[model samples]
Target chain A: MSDSLFENLRLELRRGCLTLAVLANLRTERYGYTLRKALEEAGLEMDEGTLYPLLRRLEGQGLLASEWREENKRRKRFYRLTPDGERMFDHLAAELQRINASLERIIAEAHA
Target chain B: MTTLFERYLHAVGEALPKDVVAADVTAEIADDLHSRAEEREAELGRELTDEEAAAILREYGDPRVVAARYGRVQSLIGPELLPYYWSTLTLALVVVVALELVVGGISAIVRADGLRFFSALDVAVHSLVWVFTIVTVIFAAAERVPQGRQRLARVMRWDPRALAAPSALPPVARSSSLAEFIANTLALLVLLDARGAHRVPLDRLVATMLSDLHLTLTVAWQPALVGTAVGAALVAIAAMIAFLRPQAAVVHEMLRMLGSVVAIVGLAMTLASGPLFDPGGGIATTIGYVTLGAAIAVLAVQAVLSVRALLVRAPMPTPKSARG
Candidate 1:
């Protein structure tokens, strides 16, 4: 595949996983900068504009709660998943697993 | 330190809404660009200049597009509303045109023999009526279209924050005001000429009115002229007010009321004066009076519809508890 085409497919895949990734990472409380770096380390690059708004939206929708706290002499807003978010995340994770298994089966059959 | 990367980020930041373009986002993007440039430089075993980093940032699509991707939902008007808009517009235009024709035909029949007496005045009034009908119908039709509504909505969404910031008035309002001014001036001149002569011939009447008035010493004509001017000015002002404040609803209603009043007065003056103040004989004059009455009726109906549409309130959104 062309690099550009592959990049687009990768972005499409990442788009679905963004909410999941944010929830998974927020299983522990983390600030915007730390969460961004962690996601990049896991090979999922997100820009600040995309991430911050998603955080705000998720919080608005009651999936996440956030508060500004003093950390290392700097004011940082940290986010964490609510109980509702945790239940939603588990449902999503199960659905993702099923999708992954189906995809893997298709790929294995194609190779065989 | 100020760098090309920082400047690029700033350019993008300026394009975004203030709340979206926070200092944190700016700093993070700036850092990413700097790190990427440094990494590329180290890998190549050479120094990457600020200019080279700037070029890379430019190759990435414009900052506005990048920022927009975060949460910019599509803004298209839904397809379902298009048919409603088109049907309503076509129906309204047909009704208005039909009304104009009916009134025009009645007047023509009534003044059939008196044509000679009021020929100039008849032509002028007919032309003015035609022009007003065409212009208003066009405006009403345009307003019903989805794109027109969107354009109107944008104009209406005035932020006091934006008011202090430099922005030009929307082009639609500006152009409409200019057109209204010109139309009013022309209408005033024609109406004044029509009123000035009692029963003179067309050519002689115009010549006499112009020659006697000489354009400069036309102060005596100011009352009628100013009345028409004021009416036109009100309509134009009302349109701008409607454009800026569609939610108010009353502004549009007021415009419709004011327009009806002007039309009524103009029609009454035209009919009562009898083709430029020369009273005609027989059924022709009676027909002219009836035609004037029909025009008044049409205006009255339009005023009622405008008021009804404006005053009818939409049902309030049900509360969450009620929804359950």
Candidate 2:
């Protein structure tokens, strides 16, 4: 398969998990660069441009709260989910589970 | 020495809104680019130059595109507000055009020779109205867009709590006396100064007054004067009611309704006493009649909306115990 095709598949797979990945990782206070690294380490690759704005919007929607802190002579903005965000994350996780189960059933039937 | 990569970073930083995207984001992006370039240099066993780093940055696309992605996560205004904005704009345009035509017809009657003058004035006013309408529509749309919303939020330094707070209706009932005073003063001045009652000068005067006064005064003065002597009396009553309650939304509704009534009355008087006040009976007369009529209609609609808002009670908040 071509590299472009592989890259497209990777993007589609990552896009599916992006929201869940962000909510899960933000359980700990982390800035943009650290969050990106953590997601990559977990096998979900995201670009800097995509991560930063998603963080801001999630924060805006009251799902996340952020504060700027200085550490090791560097300024970093750390974000964490609010109580509302936690509740929403649980709801979304359940919805994603139902979706995954449905997809698994359909694939199993096709193989059968 | 500073490299071309540094120059590119600076340019992007300058283009973006300073408040939304932090300095650290720029620094991190620059650092990442430098690291990438170094990795490439090591792989090729050659030193990467400033130009090569700049080339890599360029391939990443314009800084604005990157910055915009950050802001475009969600819309501010969404599709809901579009209908209301369009309806308001269309109504305003129709009323203004209708007024211009009526004035043109009237002027054509009084002055047999100066049809061209009326036509020119009509074109000029129409052009101005179109320009203002377009600008307002663009502004309203941009405010809804994420990038525009971010810029506006930065400029306005908006308080999120203000959205959750109960709406405070203006104390219209208390301010009726003040409204009446302003209305009566303006109406008497217009009626007495019937000397220069032509449309062009009077319209200019009204615009100038609206621009200078506070919002409360502007809403009150025009309506009280135009509707009736009864409108002036309503203004006093509205002001008193507004003052006594201070918190009641109804006061504002009353004042707005009174103001619209006065404005309509004043317009009627101007039309009825026409050419008698200004015998020039040409382009000026036509312009005056149309402008006054349009102004009245606009004020009347606004007043009605204000009253409606006042009369409607906002829903009560759910008690904390009820949620459990």
Best by lDDT: 2
Candidate 1 lDDT, A4-112, residue by residue in tens = 9998998888887998999999999998878988999998888766787688778878999887677655566778999998998999999999999999999999999
lDDT string for model 2 (B1-324, tens) is 146777667766776655666575576566556556766788989977767766777776788777666554344344644454454455455345434533543343234223433483467477657956674766576765667745644554547656543554644443464565566535533432322233445745754653453211222223223344334334533443444445544644666586566657766666665351223455545665687778777867877787777667667587999779
TM-score of chain B of each: 0.32, 0.38
Please, what are the lDDT tens digits per residue for candidate 2 over residues A64-92?
Answer: 99887776565567789899999989998
Clashing pairs in 1: B110-B284
Q: Every model's DockQ, to 2 decimals?
A: 0.14, 0.22
Per residue, candidate 1 scores C-alpha lDDT tens digits across B157-185 of: 65754633221222234455456545643
Number of clashes recorded per candidate = 1, 27
Error of 2 at B51 (Å): 3.9
Q: What is the DockQ score of candidate 2, to 2 decimals?
A: 0.22
By TM-score, the best candidate is: 2
What lDDT does the true structure give each of the candidates? 0.59, 0.61
What C-alpha lDDT, on a 0 to 100 scale, does residue B205 get in candidate 2?
75
